[model samples]
Target: MIWSLIILCGVITFLIRFVPLSGIISSDLPLSVKQSFKYIPLAVLTPIIVSDLSIMENKNFFIIDNFKLYAALIATLAALIWNNVLATISIGMASFLIMSNF
Candidate 1:
């Protein structure tokens, strides 16, 4: 089952790239299409990140000492300051681990 799911995902991913880049859809995608695709990462990531902030450990974000929320804030700051993906992720995960152990 897992193998089939993986294969299906790979095939779908390949087609998403191939159909556009291969010119089957268009040789030059419109400016609008390109701009929309840029937001795809944010659209995909926001909910996944929000779940940790809101519902992780069965607690609300406003509750005191929510480590995931703190970690996310740290990660957001790191991203804004350093603009480095590796640094943001490392700091976020590290802070979460440390705070959770406290």
Candidate 2:
């Protein structure tokens, strides 16, 4: 299972690299197409963050005691304020640790 996952990821990585170099997607992309490309990060990040915030270990969901949700909010704020990758990560980790213990 792990090997297949690794191989699959490798193949995906290779294709992501290869497609541009191979000229499969040309630089002649339309204005709309180029603009929509801006959403790729949000498209990728939204599902991961949303799923994490919306799920619980017991297969139930509640927002009242959601320390992770709070931590994520804090982290997002830190990211916006500091705009530094290391600071955002540190703040996120520290906030999660502090919130979860309380």
- TM per model? 0.77, 0.77
Off by over 4 Å in 2: 55-61
Output the TM-score of candidate 1.
Answer: 0.77
Error of 2 at 10 (Å): 1.6
1-102: candidate 2 lDDT, tens digit per residue: 999999999999999889888977886878998899899999999989978887565677768888778888999999999999999889988998998886
What tens-digit string does per-residue lDDT give for candidate 1 at 1-102?
A: 999999999999999878866766756768998899889999999998887587455453364777888899999999999999999999999999999998
lDDT of each: 0.86, 0.87
Give lDDT: candidate 2, residue 35. 98
Clashes of each: 0, 0
